[model samples]
Target: MVSREIRASVHWGVAHALPTVFLRRAAAQGDLQARLIRVGSRGTDEVFDLVEEIRARGPLYRSRIGYVATSHAAVRHLLTSDDFRTGLPTDQGPIGRVARWAAPTTLHPVEPPSLLVTEPPDHTRYRRLVTRVFTMRAVERLRARTGEIAADLLDRLETRASGPVDLVEAYCAQLPVTVIAEILGVPEAERARVLEFGSGAAPSLDLGLGYRRYRSVTRALAQFDDWLGGHLDRLRHDPGDHLLGQLVAVRDEGEGLSETELKATAGLVLAAGFETTVNLLGNGIALLRDHPDERARVVADPALWPNVVEETLRLDPPVLLTGRMAVRDTELAGQPVRAGSMVTAILGGANRDPEVFDDPVSFDVGRANARDHIAFSAGRHHCLGAQLARMEGEVGLRAVWDRFPDLRLETGARRRETRILRGFERLPATLRP
Candidate 1:
């Protein structure tokens, strides 16, 4: 165990600390992307302003880290083009060698076989299995279940003894976790534990953490890994008919994922399945409450609820940005990009590109092109649960307003501090007008 801790420490230095040093220095030198990353978290308006600053520089801004893509066209191209692939540029140095050797073997979203980092072939295979079970039709079928879950949660919210209640804790978080737990066959008794694990492990996607926080995150990850292994083992012995059970049974062509692959895939799906939607629900609720005029517009036109979700996603995305590395020397947005260069696509910024939408930052529920925003990302790496997330966001937010049309946000709503993912950690609100 001591040796494991040593390895993790060494791994953190190479994987996180080294880059953090350069990023902090670059941030100090006024590099917009560097500042954005090094700060780790920022207020909504300020973060957008920083992204716009990078955009104002040109289509692509080069920072000490690599290139940052903010324009709608540039970001779309960076995400969609074959020249760029997901994951950071490989480090082929002695430090890289040591880092790779010291890295933990835990199943994580940033690691291989998780689909987030895996390219074609394996990615195609794993995605195929998941898509078979997580299809749009499958998601659409769950809409009624999702709405039912929202209604049930609101009932609990209504029963709470008065004063400001945290909407994130009572509604936004519970609704999606319950829905996803049902989808993944997680027993109701174990749902809270799953949520805890996801919350603890979420920072694994970010960069540059202090050692104390890093150790905590690593422990959480290991715990989640052990729990999932047990869960999957139980499923293997007596698999049910749910999506994960089907995955366990190797439903697609009988080509099952190995235990590590299965664990990686399941962990990613479980965490990602709810985390982003948690952000989406919270962001949508806050956006609607803050923009009562648009909220009223949607209330009058019940059919616009779906559009409301799209518009919210456009104005304030759940995810801020994603990074990709150039697979080969290539050109992007008329600029030459060399092989191994990294391009950080600021999804939040791209959604607000003036070329795509009018008054890009304003919350417009009726915006016709709101769906054009790539909040779920694009190309081969598009979010597998996009439809499910949209369904949850639409149903969850509408349910809140439908149940309590006069719901008022309190003064203490707080945004989450994770660098890539954005949303509220706590959203205090009054159920009554």
Candidate 2:
């Protein structure tokens, strides 16, 4: 599990980095909010402990400012239920004391809505536009290209092996960023610029980020928005098969997709596409190091690489928690929820529910029920990049094994400071000397 000390330099989720919500409203901010909300800051293991306690109480339990769903049954229900919506509650209501922080007056690049935030008619429309393009079929087409990218990155990584290497930074983090950049048709020269935005602008999604991080996020978003505007203009005149070109063509088609949606969606793809997959690779690699028995299995068969990926996802998901708001008065597991209520779905807890997964904490590569885990969340807002992420994980992990079959984690491996979506900032590894 990753730590919750994430700064702007490590991970940021664009629109999701921060929000005016029932849950995070009480969370500690960097002097951004006048009142502080106590969301029980804890390390990874402790957080999981709390999740177990909460789930044991019942499917739905009251949290700092809202309800937290712990059971897999409850979480799946809330996620798939039309009663719960994607958007957060804008009004502070009873929690206004901790919710009244004034963010930057400047226009944020992450706003004007993306698929990650909007609900109903808007989500329906925007989702339809990209559904066919982002489907498993579409993502599968990139498998060969992703493998090539993974191979090249692994080549550079292996050559740099003077001693122990930070696999997370060198290999895991680099592959997805490069792949997403190319897929977006970001010019080779401008790829770094996209990376700058993707890496720097993520804290905007975390309401708990201190004022320092918040201010940094504000600046990053402004810069990202400005550059993206120019990038879109260049693509408008000369479209390609890249996602940007496809979106630009959609804009020209005059059917749907607003400029705001285009910019937000693009930012979402860059930040989200890069960050979550980084953690997946990091966590998966770390798991292999800890579970050499499973490692040996994959090392022998190689055919079990996909199984390794699935089990890794089950044991240690990239995204630990997500939010959903009640669109109308409803009951979850017999707990009454008001029309405008919110729930923090403890995904980490759900994945480990004894009811769903036996010995859920144990990392088993051959676990038959591994795919049943909702590491990607479920229902309407399921991760759009799930298939693509799986492909990258398989390709990325296999490359590591192929290049360094004797690879093992170095002593000083470090998890990222992110609480919501767990990952690593520095995961050192070395082939046995």
Candidate 3:
């Protein structure tokens, strides 16, 4: 019998390493999609230039791995079509079987039972229960609390000694985590641990991770699963008035999530609750700082704050790309795609589709159609926390500038290395000019 670590290593090799090797060779051969996967932020110009190159190739271009969609219409069709489904590609043959068998049963965003991958009637059931508690009204109610949290976090930043501080860590990450923890009824004391686990596991969303990072991510997921199970068990006995407690109540009172489903749902909620928002906040601050003219416009009129958030999302989305597998033979944007083909949707590229918005690459905070970008995705799998994230972005960003209108973005900002999730890992800035 293979040990758990050995099994996980095999799974990583099959799932990640092989793909990395294929992509590297393809990238060297000038495969645009493969190149996009390997693109970094030495400067974002190269990323966008490659995206435009893919766009120039037409709506749906075939790459070494599979189909690549960069056009707004094509990407929207892929995301919203019933002929396609979400999740990783289904491996075939004996080695593929071993890879699947070796995978440990953990609550992963990409794994089955998690809303990211499940299809109806299970998907419908899980979504309905979660939506009931995580409604628009519920998010609106928390807007005030979110503002307060942002203000408090900025206040702490202001008190720190005058020097370059990593805003991503000190402010961007803290505000949303605090707000989400309050919503989930997670004790304040455990929020730091939650953030640590989230940071460790975040790279799981990216592709082609090295063995060291893969091992660390799997370990984080396993530990997070253990902690989540105990927390859910505690909630079972005393379901409080929080969103997670309500989910527990729903689970106990007849046709609802099983123990495994409950853990998966709750864990996704916890990790996703802040991860993207952290990216959004960081991206917004950087965008505003870089475009000082726009920052001045926002400062002159506070009502434009929400639009700032939308424009930031449009210009630099947290999740750079997502993919869907063809469920059956289908035609997308007049192109024939056979069954079992994978179509990668470059969300960032689609957001810059020249046909959608005039001067698509320009950072216009007042761009009327800024909200039309699918930064949160589309169709059934649209981000469940879209409203919450928008609120956090607006409030968190507004609080930062409101407290210190002359905040200076110092040199040495660094972007997160993950290809899929785009944001700053370190945004050096001084609170006062």
Candidate 4:
């Protein structure tokens, strides 16, 4: 149980504050317990305590509002159910409190809309367009390319293999960017700029930053629009057989994507397809190095690739969380949520939900229900690049294992500063050649 004072403090001071500050305090306090909880003014402090409790106890636990907000019935209503649709509390303003506060540009201030942001029609439309190129069949075409990229990266790692190499920078991060760049027909020179802009634009999803983040993202979007527009123009005049060319040729319902929509769609595809997969590969490799037994199993039996990928996703998802606005005044679990409130679906937390997974903390590649995890999410907003991501992981891991059968993590591992994309900034590994 959490202390009442702490609960009250978090409820009053933390709920409405900037999430960065809130998470900072929470991290500093080292009190991240509770599962599937809400924190707001009034009784929201309890949510923080609950989060801490969940962290403390295991992966899953119940949450309750502070003493003042609701009855025992209301508390029960919020918990003991999976109807996340209703549990979110509603906003009470014109712009909608969440929209005002949780601007995408403010939280990350960098990075782009990589499937985590955007809702409904826009999300659906963009997802549909990219889905055509990112399909399992389409991604299969990249198998040879992905293998070549992995082999080239490994070759580079071996050549410059002095001291401790950051596996992330050397291999994981580079692989996806290279692959996606080729796929999207982005010029080699512009790849670095595209990555920088995408990364800078990602943090805007945190609801606390709101308009501030949006402004920054808009600027980045403008740059991406300009750069990609020129790229598209070149592709139009001299069409290549790449994914972007296909996108340009696509006409849905006799209505092709507008110039702005095409750019936005391209931005989304590149950002999501490249960044998240890079992080996933990076994180998965790190985890393998950390857990030797798992690595040995993967090396011995490449057949376990799918399960290994699922377990990796379960333990460390690339996209930690996603946001959605309520379409209607609905009840989630048992909470009263008004229409248009912001909801942060904790994909990381949800994947580790004990009720859904056994021994959630442990890394078991062979876990029976591992595939049921929501690393790709559910419903209309599932990742369009899911198949592509899986293929990348399998190819990357297989190539690494086949090339260097005795790879192990060096003494030190450093993670990236960004929390939204969970992976290594640098993972020093020794390849036994």
Listed per candidate, the RMSD to the true structure in angstroms reads 1.6, 6.4, 1.5, 8.9
Model 1, position 2, has a per-residue lDDT of 51
lDDT, candidate 1, 64-168, per-residue tens: 789999988999999889899987765557876886789888877888878999998899888887886567888889999898899889888887727789988
lDDT of 3: 0.86
Sort by TM-score, best first.
1, 3, 2, 4
**lDDT scores for all predictions?**
0.87, 0.74, 0.86, 0.61
Residue 385 displacement (Å), model 4: 0.1
Q: TM-score of model 3 relative to the true fold?
A: 0.97
Is 3 or 4 the stronger prediction by TM-score?
3
RMSD of 2: 6.4
Q: Evaluated with lDDT, which candidate comes out highest?
A: 1
Model 1 regions lying over 4 Å from their true place: 251-254
TM-score of the candidate numbered 1?
Answer: 0.97
CA error at residue 377 for candidate 2, angstroms: 1.4
Pairs with backbone N, CA or C atoms under 3 Å apart (clashes), candidate 3? none
TM-score of each model, paired residue for residue: 0.97, 0.87, 0.97, 0.74
Q: For residues 43-117, what per-residue lDDT tens digits would candidate 2 score against the true structure?
A: 245567666667766888775457888788888998999999765575445333223233332334323467776
Per-residue error at 116 for model 1, in Å?
A: 0.4
